[model samples]
Target: MSLENHAEFKLSITKALGDQLAAALKKLAPAPLAMENIRALRPLPGVYQLYKNGHLVYVGKADRSLPQRIEKHFRKISGRRNISLDQMAFTCLYVDEDFGAVAPERLLINEHRGQGQVPWNYNGFGNNDPGKRRDTTEVDEGHFDHDHPIDLEYRLTKLPSQCMEAGEALPLSQLLQETKTHLPYVFRYQASKEFDDIAVEFPDAETTADEALKTIAARLPDKWQITALPGYLIMYPKIEDYPSARRYYRSTGVVDVW
Candidate 1:
C-alpha cells in the first residue's frame, strides 16, 4: 500500500479506538473530592481523570498507588495546589499492573485533547513519545570531512584576577580539574569575548540560552561571573589541544607554540 493510504488506515483505527474509549470513560461516574471519597480509592496502579464543572481538565497516571497519588493532588504536595478542588471531581480506572496504565493514560489524554477538553494538561500524558527526529549523519560527517573547526564561546562579567596574574596564567589541568570538581555540567569551552573570558555551550535542542546561562552561573564560584550572549559566536582551539593550549590569553605576549 502507498504510504498515504497506510497512514490514513492507521489514523482511522486510532480514531475508532479513541471514540470507544471516550464513550466508556463517560459512563464511569465521577467521584467527589471529600475525605470519604478519597479514602475509598484503590491502591492499585491506574489512570485518573480530573474534571472541573463537568469538563475534563487533566488526565494523569499513577504506577505505584493510585490513592496516594490522588491524595497528593488534593493536598497540593504534587505542586498542583493552584488547582481548586472545590468544584473538581475525578474518575479512575484501576489497572492490574503498573505498565497497563501507560496506554490508557496516553489514549485518554489524546482523546480529550482532540475534543479540546483538557486545556490545563500540557502536551498530553505519554512519557515515551519520541518527539521530532533529525538525521544528522551527513552533517556530522561533513564537519570532519571539511576540517571545519567549531568553538563554543561564553561571555563573562567578573573574571577573577588571580586566574590571569602576570606570568602566572592558570594551567589547563587546574582549570579542567576545578571545572570537573565544581562545574561538571560544563562539557566544552570554545572561545571568549575577551582574552580573560571563556565560553560554554549546551545542546540547543535540550536547553535554552537563558537556562544554560543560569545553570552555568549558579554552578560557578561567587568570585567569578558569567553572562549570556544569545547570538554571539567566537572561535578557539579544540578541547584536545588544551594540554598545550595557553590557560589564559594576553594580546601583548609572544604567542606560545601549541
Candidate 2:
C-alpha cells in the first residue's frame, strides 16, 4: 500500500474506534492536548503520549510538570508545517518523583513495540544502562592528545575600556563565525585578573602562524598592543598574574580550548 493510503487506513481505524477508544481513554482522564488547557494539567512528574489522529506517534516522560513538558511539545509543533496541533492528543499519568516516571515509560514503550505499535522511541526508550567502557590502556593515549606539537602563531590585543568595564567579552561562538559576523582568525576570549585577553588560533597547512599573526596585527587598532608567543601553551595564569599574558601554538586537532 502507498504510504498515504496506509496513513489513511490507520486514521480510518482510529475514527471507527473513536467512541470506544474515547470511552476507554476517558477512564484514564486524558486531556485534549491544547494550549489553552495545558495550564490546567497537574504540575507533577509523569509519562505522556502524543497521538496523531488517535494513532500513537510518540511517548515521553517528564521529570518536571507534565503541563510544561506538553506545552513545549505544542510550541515545537506549532512552527512545523508537517505536524499540526489540531490532530494531536495526549494522555498522562502522574508519578511521585522524577525517577519513578522512567520505568513506567520504558514499560509502555516496550509493550507498544511488542504489539507493533512502533511509537517513535528510537533510542531504546528509558534504557539507562551506561554500556561497557572500552579499555584504552594499550591504546597510545598520545594519539588522542590535542597538544601535539604544531607551529602556532597568535595575536594579543588590549580590550577597549568599555568592553573591560562591562565584561562584554566576545564568545568563542562569535569568534568562530557561528554568528552572522565573519573574522579572518579563530580566537578565544578570556578575562584575567590583569587584563582581558583574546587568543587567536592558527590551524595547520593553510597559513603559517607567523603570516596569520602579521595579518591579524595589521588589521587590529593601534590602541591594542600585539605580542607573539613562541610555542603551544595552554593559558592557566595565576590569580596574582592578573594580567599575565602569553601566546601558544594551538595544535591542528585541537577542537576546543574552553
Off by over 4 Å in 1: 1-17, 77-83, 98-102, 123-258
Evaluated against the true structure, the overall lDDT of model 2 is 0.43
Question: What is the lDDT of every predicted structure here?
Answer: 0.46, 0.43
Candidate 2, 49-154: lDDT as tens digits: 7777877766677887889888866744443334457887888767667456235566566556665563456622222211212111121212211121123422
Model 2 residue pairs with clashes: 194-242, 194-243, 231-249, 232-249
lDDT (tens digit, per residue) of candidate 1 on 68-184: 777755633111212345777888877657346347677777888877887656632221212212111122322211122112222222234224534544433334333323221
lDDT of 1: 0.46
What lDDT is reached at residue 174 by model 2? 30
RMSD of 1: 16.2
User: Each candidate's root-mean-square deviation in Å?
Assistant: 16.2, 17.3
Candidate number achieving the greatest lDDT relative to the actual structure: 1
lDDT, residue 152, model 2? 41
